[model samples]
Target: MKVRALAGVALLTTMTLTGSPATAGAPTTAAPAHPTAPQQATGLRAVADRAGLRIGTAVDMNALADDAPYRAAVAREFSTVTAENVMKWESTEPQRGVHDWAAADRLIDFARANRQKVRGHTLVWHNQNPAWVNERDLTPAQLRAVLRQHIIDEVTHFKGRVWHWDVVNEVFNDDGTWRDTIWLRNLGQGYVADAFRWAHQADPQAKLFLNDYNNEGVSAKSDAYYALVKQLKAAGVPVHGYGVQGHLAVQYGVPGDTLTNLRRFERLGLQTAFTEVDVRMPLPADPIKVQAQAQGFTALLQACLLADRCVSYTLWGFTDRYSWVPGVFDGEGSATPLDENLTPKPAYAALRDTLAIAAR
Candidate 1:
């Protein structure tokens, strides 16, 4: 997924908490420290266990495999896990009719070992699709058939294991227009409905969601989703959830109407989630920037907690060690709660404080 700042956004951007002692390869100038060991009573998962919500983070499979501290933090902090990339179409099916489930299976197994639920990210999206699924090469009928099969097969393979499937992702652009991707160009907007139905058929027990960024607050994009959800409901489509990819930046500030937006969706009989959350700032961090970042992280979380049926709050990645932000957005990093050395930041503290209060 590409990272681009929202247009006409001011660059600027919360929480309190303690930190664990820095480990090997720690940055020379560390973030202000918090007492993480004493705060173990309020580990994100521990507090979230009582808050009636699942706290999750996207897992970088390689880090889970090779980085001990990273692996440990993932298991300790989150109640659920989302694959950062491995479960996407390109990674899962590199070639036509050839599927690779090893990496995804490993994540599922890890989640099970830790008694965490797996959130199956993205059965359908414009990005990270396999190279073979060419727009110019396949006709609409052929494309539709392939997409249906992919959803069914992928969902079926993980049926009882996955708690939620982002069945269709980023189908609409920031302005509420259908993104001119292969699915929309070929199968039309009905592809969203078809993807959800196919996923439901494959895993009747799994919750299905439509996910997108820049739609966190009520706007043209969310309005479009509201209308689509209504239409799908009227037509008896099996869409179950609306996902707000809470990918905020300090410069953009947090959306003020997030709760209002979420409430409207809940009233429509759908669950809501703050998926893919991370608040990045301009590099060379300072006190003000980090403080704003914490607020950005907590604002979305507060909306989820306040909403009647917002089921989960998931960090795009829990630690900066494997963050996709720096690479994608030059001069911007430290998007996750933990820093690169796996030390907790103020953002981590803020989340802990928020969840701790909810737990109480």
Candidate 2:
């Protein structure tokens, strides 16, 4: 655990109690420029001590095959991890007849070896699914069987290792109504309840959450999610929390409204999380704009700290080098609190300061 405490490697040799420092052998050796060992980053524990925040990173398993910079960055930058894409249904189970866990297995392995917490991405969503899962081709009865089997097999596969599962993702539309996805269209409302129940049956200990992209702020979308959760809980479903994906833009609704919705979710006896937090900003960011972005992170963290049920806060990506914003948004932007070079931006410091302040 103490091997990679810094960028360079250091060796420890035990000595007899009566031995003096003069008895030690050569302590100097050529070391790697970047820290690839865990013991090296323990040296960064000083920085973390002063920062007082649960810094984390999102790991893309495919990147682990290459992407040295990313690998070194995550190994050195954060102690906690979230699977960047491995846990997605399309990645974990690309074919109906097969469940490929090679990618997800890497994430689970990394988490276990590091003793780190993992936030399992999604079980059900409108996107990131194979075309075969589309209900347009299947009869109602057939679709129900497919959905049931998918949930059961996938959940059972990663039962104890995955601490949290986004059991149902993007279940609601932006207007606060249920989506018209294959699951909803085929199985009706019972499908949503059944997903959570099936996940519980497969892994009774996994914390389940409903995740969405935009509902960061209190609006029609958020209120709709709230009402749906209330209905689910009333029916005694296994729904545990709401994941308000924090992908705030400078132009959208008031950012504080996200916190308002979070607090409201907590009131309903459910946990809350800033599931996919990323404050996007136009490139060549202005000082004021960057501060606003940082403030957004602080606001989200503040909501979590204040809400009794709120537990985890995760950045969409630790660095701007690999965010999904560029693919989804037309214009180029940086969505992460950390700079592309992996340096802590003002937003990062603000996040640290926010947590420190919260701790007090």
Candidate 3:
């Protein structure tokens, strides 16, 4: 998830913080009444399978071991998995040259055991860097060497296990300017292309993606990605996909041009995905808010279904019990398909209905 300073007010402020699902609140005037019975709880993976796409969720290592029900739900509902944090630079290599694969390896093993594919969370990001990456004060050439080695070693370790790698994450500011992260400060914009290239060299079969939030619709941020992707494609950078982190808030309503935005990326011959979908609502979620959240989730799924090149829909997390929203944002949460008790919510049913229609 991309963590940035909160901006705007009401809807926009909520949107800036990141993503999740909803609960059973009062129905808004536009929303359909909550279904008394949410179908047969047909797993999302089954519905997605019928539509020729994958439904996935981010997983934490501790959840796999400590929460039997959560693990069961993951295997039962999702066809793909992404490590929430274990694959990031800070988690994988906390110290110089000392790689830690224990947590990440467990996720890959679990995915394989359940006949699911793994999407490596990230290979390069502006956040979650180990202290040494910046504290060492390395020269441009030295920093570039460090980045190349990190991508190569990490991608090589996973090899055939991962189906997709988020080669570069959240590289552009909301205004479309390149973010001045350590990578940009040290190696400039070329680092983005180099990161994708090195990852491809390490894992030829793995699909590479540039992942970010607030790019679910046509905007300055997404426009920046479009230009960069065009350049990368012309140069044969091996970028196979573009990720739209669908971290929405009901207060703002869904982005009207989400499908249009995704289709544009498809025209560039890149696969698009709702990489981190979660429709959060303000605290004390009323029925109106829940209904809106359900509508938001349905719209997003419909958008993905409409886009031929959109290959997957992945939630940041599935259940509200372990959601990352409340910890990060005050007076906001309940952004997942399942409530704290692991029962399917209105959003889950909305997703099912959308997938069912698409499957037909």
Mind giving the per-residue lDDT tens digits that candidate 1 earns over 1-360?
111122222212121111111111111111111111221456898888877789999877777777666777777788899988788888778898998888888888888778789999889988778888986788889999999989988998998999999998887767788889888888888889889889999999999998888887778889999999999999999999999888777876777788888999999999999888888888889999999888888888877877788999998888888888877777988888988898899999988877766665
* Off by more than 4 A, model 1: 1-40
Ranking by TM-score: 1, 3, 2
Q: Candidate 3, residues 261-300: lDDT per residue as tens digits?
A: 8999999999998888888889998899999888777777
Error of 3 at 338 (Å): 0.6
lDDT on C-alpha atoms for all candidate structures: 0.80, 0.66, 0.79
TM-scores across all candidates?
Answer: 0.89, 0.82, 0.89
The backbone clash count of each candidate, in order, is 9, 10, 8
* Model 3 accuracy (lDDT, Cα): 0.79
- Estimate candidate 1's alpha-carbon lDDT, on a 0 to 1 scale: 0.80
TM-score of candidate 2 to 2 decimals: 0.82
lDDT of 2 at 273: 75
By summed lDDT, which 10 consecutive residues of candidate 1 come out lowest?
A: 18-27
Model 2 lDDT tens row, 290-328: 866776666666666655666677777767766666666
The residue ranges of model 3 lying beyond 4 angstroms of the native Cα positions read 1-41
